[model samples]
Target chain A: MGQVVVVTSGKGGVGKTTTTANVGLALGMFGQRVCLIDTDIGLRNLDLALGLDERVVYDLIDVCSGVCRLQQALLRDKHIETVYLLPAAQTKAKTDITPEQMRTLLEQLKPSFDFILLDSPAGIEQGFQNAIAGADWAIVVTNPEPAAVRDADRVIGLLHGAGLTDVRLILNRLRTQRLDARSTGNGTAGLGEIEEVVDQLAVDLLGVVPEDERVVDSNLQKEPLVLHQQDRAGQAYREIARRMLGESIPLMELTPPKPFWRRLGLRFGHHARVERK
Target chain B: MGHRDPSLTRKWGQGGKRRAMAYLPSHIRVKGSRDGLTFYFDGNVAMEVWLAELQQLLQREHHLFQGPAVPVRICFGRVPLGTEEAAIRACFASHPNLIVHRVEASSTSITSRTGEKERTAPTLLWGPVRSGAEIQSDGALIVAGDVHSGARLVAKGTILVFGILRGMACAGSDGDIEAIIAAWELACPVVEIASRRKSFEKLSAGPTLVRLEGEELVTAPARHLKRGQGGREQPWAKWWS
Candidate 1:
């Protein structure tokens, strides 16, 4: 049997689909058979991200409703032989498939695949409920903003309540620019540090993806970011994939800026130091 | 002895249609545990028949108890008790060997006095409480982790957090001002006790306690209470205790 993981964020536009693509592809690079299931029924984007939009003749709904076999709905990546893509139907709403159907589908695929990642929709409605119905684990993606962290917290609570207690956090789109602690001036606490987000959610930190323009460009280029070498976000996803497979990998350190750059309040040549495992 | 779903009885007894009431076991039952003795009354049976059955059972089994009068509770499974609980209590008053502790309509109904006094066990939560998430208890609540901002914790008695509290904590929600809300560090933006509210923008220097004093919420350092000492003046030895 294989492990099924769901990538979800309560708020929209928080890189859930992007994380699913990168992490799923990264696991494929490690010689594991990975399947990416897009559960965002009405607003499908995983197919576009994986360059399989044109090949999605049969979707998740077709497979669940017995219109097509599971293998017929799955499209193999032309380049990466280890990974597969299960696209969502753009015309159908999330309620078209019940949670029992989703769970049954995952059960049939668990024996053939090594890992299944469900790309959950933006809200905690029927779409989110169906996505997590069969998931064995959950990856909560969030940004450094308060709203994102708050949404992540609510998702974490919902996950625990639903019995998906094996959850981890992935802090995404973090700016490398470090802010001075004294600048928060107000009496309220500022969620500037990644540790604060981890502490607030009380979840284990899986990996942190830094803010990089290339990540957005990869979607347009129809390429997974992990295939792009030397990109900070790509390296973070690769590291997350390694940690998922029971590897003891420490977090990449956020290097401090030069004294001259710090004094000038400029970010120049700041990179996270990572020792390859 | 088995726990019966309260809804199975209420819909049939209250609505008076009783299409499904025939399936309910038509007998008076009794269960005894560390909590107390509970006399179970069926919703389908007539109240007079239930009383007679219970009296007959007690009369036959009174020899089993050689001690003083035993405190027992009366429970109505499916009946929607509007104002007849007193009549049931008055009928039970003639049983000299039994002391009536309470009469409960349902075990899970918050409106019942039984839920307020006995059913409310301090709920212990594992991880941090998130924003927009809520945890409510009829009596007391204790969080083993931090409570993030925008999260709400409500309890009828005391509210204690083993970790930091940066959210809202309301204790003694029914205007019992003595109920206190404590935390390892309190930086809550909103805190309420007995309908009174206060806001804390910054965390105190040490572990803190919040309680209502003379219509105003007051904060004080709680170093004396100490952690691992059961978190209160006297250690709560058991979960039920």
Candidate 2:
């Protein structure tokens, strides 16, 4: 049976759909048969993110409501042959699929795929409940900000309450320059350290995706970042995928480079201090 | 209805009373009393729905209740069990000045036959109060975890947070000038003690105490409060004296 993983974040616009698409694509690149399911219902974006919006003939609601078979609704990716997309219905309400129906649908698809990824909607509402209904593991995406961290904590609490104990943290949109400036006292409020976030959420760190402009370009081009290969965010996603596959890959160091003057000043200052000592 | 408002009669008309009643949300009933505005929850609707409506009502009328002295009462139709009271209190988390004067179950069994004033114990919150969550106590209030931004705590007496305080906090909510607000790390954007309010530019990293001094709210290191001194003999006694 395939392992079902749900990507969820309580707060909106924290990149739940992007992480699901890229990670699923990376897993498929590893020769695993992966199926990505969009559970956002009315506000569907996974299809657009995967560049398969035009190819979708049916959606999850259609399969759940018996209008079509699950195989008929699954859209094969053009680039990754092992990856498939199960789009969400744009016209239907989020409450269209109950948790029991979602569980049954995931169970039915488990035998055919190696990994099933559910892209959960924002908020702790019916959509969130439906997304996590049949998941064996949960990946909670959050930013370095306080609000997103708090929401992730709440999601962790809820996931634990639902008996899904294997939850990991993904810190997204980390701005290295901003964090460096804050650490050096140039910035006012620091984006908290990763250790603080891990301590607050009490979850294992899966990966950290630095804030990269290429992510927006990928979204605009309707392509998965992992396919870009050279993009830093894409490499981060690939590393995360490898980590998810139980590989012990070291985390990427994302420190921002300082200006020439600052580096020169630090070097000379260090020489002067050594001579004085 | 002996105390029915004549204006409501004129607005609803005699035959349209049922329609007017249906227009209001059945789960919530708001009324004005000598103590303050009282909100009665009938337990008919789900807690989330009731909280949403309550938040909407408060946000719509926030201008009218902008100060720290506005006493508010939350009365449940039945006594809440477990975290139900905490959930109910979370609805008022954004309104820092809205003082919760009393929270009680309106059931007759809990009320005393002698008609004396009802006393409520201080609410003890167990977990980290997240953003957009609020806790209000008619008496003293204590929280065991951090209070995030957009969350608030209002207490008629002392407000003590065992963890970091990063949100808005209002103590002496009922106009008690001697009330104190203490936290492990004081980093709140706004802190109010009775009518005195001060915004902190830089938050202290260590434990801190905020209390009123001659009508001005002052912050001092909590360790200097003089150990073994109790009651009015403490260093903060100058405010009450």
TM-score of each: 0.67, 0.62
> Looking at candidate 2, what is the lDDT of residue A225?
85
lDDT of 1 by residue, A118-218 (tens): 99999999999999999999999999898999888889889988999999999998876543342242322233587778878889999988788998788
CAPRI grade, predicted model 1: acceptable
Give DockQ per model, in order: 0.46, 0.14
Instruction: Give the top-scoring candidate (TM-score).
Output: 1
Would you give the TM-score of chain B in model 2? 0.46
TM-score of 1: 0.67
Q: Per-residue lDDT for A25-92 in model 2, tens only?
A: 99988888999999999999999999999999999999999999988999999899999999999999
Supply candidate 1's per-residue lDDT for A164.
Answer: 94
Tell me how far the alpha carbon of residue A103 in candidate 1 is from the true structure, in angstroms, after superposition.
Answer: 1.1
Worst 10 residues of 1 chain A by lDDT: A268-277
Question: Candidate 1's error at A168, in angstroms?
Answer: 1.2
For B74-178, candidate 2 gives per-residue lDDT tens digits of: 767577765777776676767877777667775422221112134445678876765656678987788998876667788987788998888789998899776
